[model samples]
Structure formats: structure tokens, C-alpha cells
Target: MWRFLSPQILFGADSTEYLERFEKRRAVIVTDEVIKNLDYVSDVSKHLENSETVTIRAREPCIDDALELAEEMREIEPEVIIALGGGSVIDVAKAGRILMEAEIEPEEITPFTSLEEYGFRGKTSLIAIPTTSGTGSEATWAIVLKNIKERRKVIMAHERAMPEIAIVDPAFVYSMPDHLVISGGFDALSHAVEAFLSSFSNPFSDSLALNSLRLILDNFIMSYGGDRDAREKMHISATMAGIAFSNSQVGVVHALAHAAGALLGIPHGLAVGAFLNPVLEFYAERGVERLGEMNRNLGLNILREIERIEAELRLFEYIPVSEIESHRSEIAERAMEDSCIVTGPFVPEREDLETVIERVVRRCMREES
Candidate 1:
């Protein structure tokens, strides 16, 4: 048996106004200092008149951040928690809501664990409003928190972690930086690709993945050039990719990206963007059937398209290839431990992961040369 999950998604322009429908219930808006300074928190708060705000540091959230936010939630006892920012802010809210109700460590929240059994009854509803068109954390049940002490990323997931609502308004992303466009767009692209190649992929996920992939490819370049219409499509496509991956799962690209991000302090989207094509090439080298199938269905070689896009965007210029090469062994070891590895088309051994990382380094070096 299989299951599909998604939040009640409100999309398009002016969707943030939907928050005004909530009546007397107390609300807490969770965001970062950067987003708060952007006055987006004020915009959201205007709709949620009876609300409080909690601003976190403007960086990737760590486990301690989640725990601290959970403690604050417990004190506020809000009926609704609005996550307003990028993936990091949304992730903190998702994990924090559960931690507020359940006395468990963030790492203890796994896919197999029954949140209901641990007394979680959704006392607080989560609403994710992303300011960037990436990560798609607004639509998924996954939460990635930095394990500071261990120097790795801790992937936490559970059905209860899925947000109750997702507001995907393009107005929030109108002024997004060029670098964010590149990183976030590639992150969405990787999600669609990895979901299609995942071992757990099913018909439902297949359709969404393909549609999302097409939309991304069609719109990403235009969106990066500051086209509003294209940005809108990219925003919606990201949510579709999120739902696709959440149901079908992701593969080696994500596993390697997670490991590299944790070790190198690169942003999640940039790390995934850098590793995506390299990992896909690794799959192709192994004669992975899904890659060929995707190529045939898309009516173009997906790998070649990726290479073109990477070149057009100058993506390889951003990644520190030498630093990644130096930490190849550590990154590969951590990748083997990532939950995403099991869902990949083929479960790779530790040495196989190292080989993939080495290839990525070589490719980046070639690009530079």
C-alpha cells in the first residue's frame, strides 16, 4: 500500500490575504531576521491581527534552534504557527510544533515512528509561506536541521510534520536575488529528477515529477532573468516537485547534497544544485534504466539539458571544488548514512559514493580549466 500527502495550498498573487480568515485564534509568526527586516513578517502579521512574532538568526537552523523555538511555542500556546521565510524558517516551525507537544529529541522523529502514539494531536497547526521559490519545505513532511556537535545534518520526518497549509504567493519572491534564483531553481530541478529515479516512485509521483520538470525547464531561465510570469510558474512547479518527492522519495543526489552541506557549510539548495548533474551522471554510468526512460519521455537527453543549463547559469563557478575534494572521504561516509540513500535507484556502497564525489570534483576542475 502507498499514501500521498499535501497541505491545503493557496497559490498565486495575494494568497497571503487568506490568513485574515482566521478569527480569534492566537497566531505566532516564525521567521528570520532577514525576512523580518524585509517587512514580510509585518505584511503577514497585518492579516493575522492577533499574532506574535519570533525572529531567529538569518542562517540555516540547527537542532538547538528548533528546540528553542519549540520552548517559545509552548509558552505562547498559539493555535496557528505561520512559518514565513525560506526552507530554514519553515523547517524550524515544522519540527518545533511537534517538539512543543511531544517530549522527544529532534533526531528521534523518524518516518516509522507514530507521532500519535507519542501524544501529538496537532494542538497547533503549521502554515508555511516561503519567500523563495525553492526547498518546497512548505509542502513536504521533511525537516533538515544542522547537527552542530556532530558536524552533520539530521534529517527528521513524520506525517505529523507536514504543514497544515502552504501559501505560495509570488509577491513574496518578486525581489529575490539572482543567486537565489539559480540555487533554488536547481534545487527544484533536482527534486523532480531524483523523485522520478527513486526506487519508491509510483504513478502518482511520476506524473507530478514529469510535469514539474517540464515547467522548471521551460521557465527557470526566464525566471532568472526577472520575468514575473516565469517566476510564478517556477514557484508553483517547486511545490509540485516537493509533493512528488515527499511521496516517492529522493535519491543519491539528495543524500550527497545533505552530507556536503553539513560538512562544507554550503546552503542546501546550492549544494543540491552543484551535486545534481554529477550524481545523475553517476546513475547513467551504471546503466540506470530510469535515466534513459526519462530521456525518452522528455524527448531530449536530460543529462545534456542539465549540462547546458549548468553552463548557461555558470553554476560550477559557485561550488568550491577543491574544498569538496579534500573532504571526499568524510562526505561519502556521511552520505551512506543518509536516509535518502536507501531510496535511490541503486543503493550505493560507501566506496561507490566516494567515486561519485571524486567524479564531481573532476568535472568541476574540468569546468574551471
Candidate 2:
């Protein structure tokens, strides 16, 4: 048996206003230092009566950062916890919320973890308000944190870790930077593509994945060019892709991205953008029949569209090709150990992963030269 899970989502122009429903309740806004200063925080805080903000100081949070936030949450004991930032901030909140209710190690938050066994009773409601259009952290159960000592990403998931509500307000994303626009677009696109190709994909996830992929392919360029309507569409599509992957899982692109992010300190979305096309090419070459099926169903060549976008946007221009080449074997080995690696349409050998890394490096070099 399979299950699909999602937060109660409030989307579009004034979705943050939904927080007004909890005006009198004790609310704690968990956000990063940078986002806490943004109008989005004020936008959310204005809708609530009793609320306070807790800033996650780290730019790219680690497990210790979540634990620190957890201690603060324990003191506040707020009725509601609103994660008000991008993926990193939301991930910290998810882990912090769990840690607040139960004294458990960060690594204990595996997919099979039983929070109830550890005295977790879900005391505080989590509301994820994503400030960016990517990562879709508001709608997903997954949590990603850096294991600083090991130089690997700690991927965690639990049904209870999912936020109780997801507010996808276009207002929050309107002022997003150009780099973020490119990164988030690619991140969402990769999510949609990988979800459709995941071994765990089902009809429900397939529908969401296909629709999101189409919307992203259609609107991403327009969104980058500052078309408000296109931005709104892309924002919605990112969440759809998140939900799709949350149910169906992602594959090697994510695995590679996660590994690179953990090892090289490359930002997750940029790493994802760099690896996405190359990994897809690897899948196609390996005769992953699902790629052909997905393209046929879309009535367009998804790969070609992705290539066009990459070229138009100069998407891989920031990739550290020399660094990647130097660390190619380590990236492949690390990716092979990722939980996401096994969920692809076909599990690849370590050698296959190396080839994909080589592909990414060559593509980066070609773009540069």
C-alpha cells in the first residue's frame, strides 16, 4: 500500500493572511537571520496577535543549529511554530520542532523513525511559509541538515515532520534575487523530472509531476524576466513538484546535489541545477525507458527544453568545474551512499555515477570555453 501526504496549503496572492486565523494563539516564527529582516516576516507577524521570532543565525544550518533553535522553542512553548524562510530555515524548524518535543539525536529522524516511541506527541503545530519559490519545504516531510564533522548532508524524514499548513504567497517571492530565480527554477524542474522517473512513483505522483514539469518549463523563463504572472505560476509549480517528489522520491540528481552541497559547500539549488541535465543524460543513455515515456506524454522533448533553458540562462556558469574534477571520485562515492540513490528508476553503479560527474564537468568546461 502507498500513501500520499500534504499540508493544508494556502496559495496565491494573499495566502499569508491565512495566519490571521491564529491571531490570539501563541506563535513563534522560526526564520533565518537574513529572512527575519525581510518584509515577509512582518507580513506574517502582522497577522498574528501573540507572536515572537527566533532567528536561525547560520546561513546554511547544521544539526547543532536546529538543536539550538529547539532549546529556544522549548522555552517559548508556542502553540504554533511558523517556519518563515527558504528550505534551510524550514528544515531547521522541522528538525527543531521534533527535537523540542522529544530529546532525540538528529540522526534519529529517519523515515522509519517512530516519534511516538520517543515521547513526541506533536504539541506544537508547524506552519511553513516559504519566502522563496524553491525547495518547497513548506509542503514536504523531508528535512536536510549538514553533518559538519562528516562533511555529509543528514537527510531526515517523518510523517509528523511535515508542516500542518503551507502558505505559498506570491507576495513573499516577488522580491527574490535573479540568482535565486534561476536556482529555484532549476530545483523545481529537477524535482518534477526526478519524481516522474523515481522507482517509487505512482499515478497520483505522476500526475502532479507531469503538470508541474509542464508549468515550470512554460513559465520559468518568463518568471526570470520578471513577469509577475509567470512568477506566480512558477511558485505554485514548485510546491506541486515538492508534493510530487515527497510522495514519489527523487533520484541521482538530488543524490549528487546533496553530496556536493555537504562536501563542497555548494548551495543546494545551484548544485542541483548543475547536476540535473547531466544526470538526466546519464539516465537516457542507460536506457531508462521512463525518460522516453515522459517525453512522449508531455508532447515535448523535456531534455531539449531543459537544455534550452540552461543555455539561455547560463545556468551552469557558476559550477566549480575544476574543483568538481579534482573531487570527482569523492562526489560519486558520497552520492552512491545517499538515500536518494536507490530510488532512481534504476540504481546506478559507482562507475555510472563517476560518468555523470564527468559529464557535468565537461558541460561546465564547454560553457566556459
Candidate 3:
């Protein structure tokens, strides 16, 4: 048996206006300082009759940060939570909302764990409004938090962790920075690619994955060039990729990205960008038939397309490749323990991961030279 899951999505122009439907209901806007400074919070708050805004300090929240937000939520006990920022803010709200309603440890949240068993009854509704066109945190059940003490990312998920709604309005992302545009595009691209290659991929996920991949591949460069039409396509594609991967899975690219982000303080999207091509190349060399199948089905060399995108956007220049090289073995070891590692089309050995990391380093070196 298989299951496909997704939040009810409100997409396109003025989708944020959907929040006004909950007029007079008590609402909390969970966001970050950066987003709060922007008009996004006020824009969202203006729709509700009664609402409070909470800003998370960390760009990437830690366990304690999520727990603290949960404690605050418990105090306010708002009827609805509006996650109004990028993936980090949305993830915190996802984790915080469940932590508020249920009495359980953060690690207890998993695909197999029954949230209902822990007294979670969805007393508080979650609505995610993504400011950026990446991470697809608004649509997925997954939550990623940092374990500061251990220097690893805590990947958590429960069916209930998914938001009740995802508002994908292009208005918010129209003014997004060029760097974010590049990073987020790559992140969405990786999601679609990894979902298609996942061991758990099914027909439902495959359709979304392929569609998202095509859209992202076609529009990423144009999106980065500040084309509103391309940006809108990217925003929609990111959510589709999120739902695709949520129902299926991400593979070695994500596993390695997660490890590097946690240990090296790299942004998740940037890390995903850095590792994507190298890992895909690794899969191709190992004769992962799915890569060839995807290429044939799309009638395009996906790797060649990725290489073009990377070069066009100077994707590798942002990463600290030498630092990553120094910690390559450690990153590989940590990645092997990630939950995403096993869900890849084929499980890789430590040596395979090392080889991929070496590829990333060498590629970056060549780019620099």
C-alpha cells in the first residue's frame, strides 16, 4: 500500500488574501526578523481581525528555539498559526505547533510515529505563506531543525506536521534577491530530481516530480534574471516539487546537504545546490538506470542541463569547497546516518559518498581556476 499526501494549496496572485477568510479568529503570525521587517507580516496580519506576530531570531532555528516558540504558542493558544517566511520560519512553526499541542520529544516525530497517540488533535490550524519560492516547507510534512550540541540537523516528520494550507503567492517572492533566486531554484530542481530517483517514488509522485522538473529546468535561468513570469513558474514548481518529494523522498543530495549545513553552517538551499550535480553524477556512474530513464523520458540530458544552470548562475562559487573538502569524510559519515540516505534509489557505501564529495571539491576547484 502507498499514500500520497499534501496540504491544500492556494496558489497564484493574491493567494495570501485567502487568510482573510478567517476573520475574527485569533491568529499568530510566525515569521523571522527579516520577513517581519518586510511588508509581508503586516500584509498577512491586516487580513485577520485579531492576530499576533512572533519573530524567530535564528535564520535557521535550533531545537531550543522551536521549543521556546512552542511554549509561546501554548500561552497564546491561538486558533491558527500563519507561518510567514522562508523554509526556516515555516519549519519552526511546524515543529512548534505540534510541540504545543502534543507532549512529546522532538525526536519522537517520525513517519512511523502516531501523533494521535501522543494526544495531538489539531486544536490549532497551521497555514504556511512562503515568501521565497523554495524549500516547499509550506506543503511538506518534513521539519528540519539543528541540534546545536551535536552539530547535526534533526530531520523530523509526522503526518500532522503538515500545514492545513499553503499559500503560494508570487507577490511575496517578486522582490527576492538574485542569490536566493539561484539557490532556491537549485533547491527546487534537486527536489524534483531526487523525488523521481527515490526508491519510494510512485505514479502520483512521479507525475508531480516530472512536471516540476520540466518547469524548473525551463525557467530557472530566466527566473534568476528577474522575469516575473519565470518567477511565478518557479514558485509554483517549488511547491509541486515539495509535494512530490513529500509523498516520495529525497536522496543522497539531501542527505549530504543536511550534513554539510549542520556541520559547516552552510545554508540548506546553497548546500543542496553544491551537492546536487555531484551526487547525480555519482548515481549516473554507478549505472542507476533511473537517471537514464528520466533523461529519456524528458528527452533532455538532465545532468548537462544542471551543469549549464550551475555555470550560468555561478552556483559553486558560493560554497566553501576547501572547507568542505577538509571535512569530507566526516560529512559522508554523518550523511550515511541520515534517514534520507536509505530512501535513495540505491543505498551507497561510505566509499561512494566519499567519491561524490571528492567530485564536488574538484568541480568547485575547476570552477574557481
Task: State, as a TM-score between 0 and 1, how close model 1 is to the true structure.
Answer: 0.98
Of the two candidates 1 and 2, the one with more favorable TM-score, higher being better, is 2
* Model 3, CA-based lDDT: 0.92
Q: Per-residue alpha-carbon lDDT of model 1 for 79-158, expressed as tens digits?
A: 99999999899999999999999878788999898777777888888999999987889999999999998888989998
* Model 2 lDDT tens row, 1-369: 999899999998888889999999999998887886675678889999999999888477799999999999999999999999888899999999999988689898988888888889998999998878879888899998998899999899998989999999898877788888988998999999999999999999999999999999999999999899999999999999999999999999999999888888888888999998888888788889999999999999888999999998898787878888999999999999999999999889999889989999989888888
Using lDDT, give the best candidate's number: 3
List candidate 1 segments past 4 Å from native: none
lDDT computed for candidate 2: 0.90
Kindly indicate the candidate among 1 and 3 with the higher TM-score: 3
Q: Tens digit of lDDT per residue, candidate 3, span 1-369? A: 988899999999988889888878999999988987786888998899999998898467788889999999999999999999988899999999999978899998998988888878889999999988889999999999999999999999988999999999999999999988987888899999999999999999999999999999999999999999999999999999999999999999999999999999998889999999889888888899999989988999999999999999998889999999999999999999999999999999999999999999999999999
Error of 2 at 330 (Å): 0.4
If both were scored by lDDT, which would come out higher, candidate 2 or candidate 3?
3
Clashes per model (N, Cα, C within 3 A): 0, 0, 0
* lDDT (Cα, 0-100) at 259 in candidate 3: 95
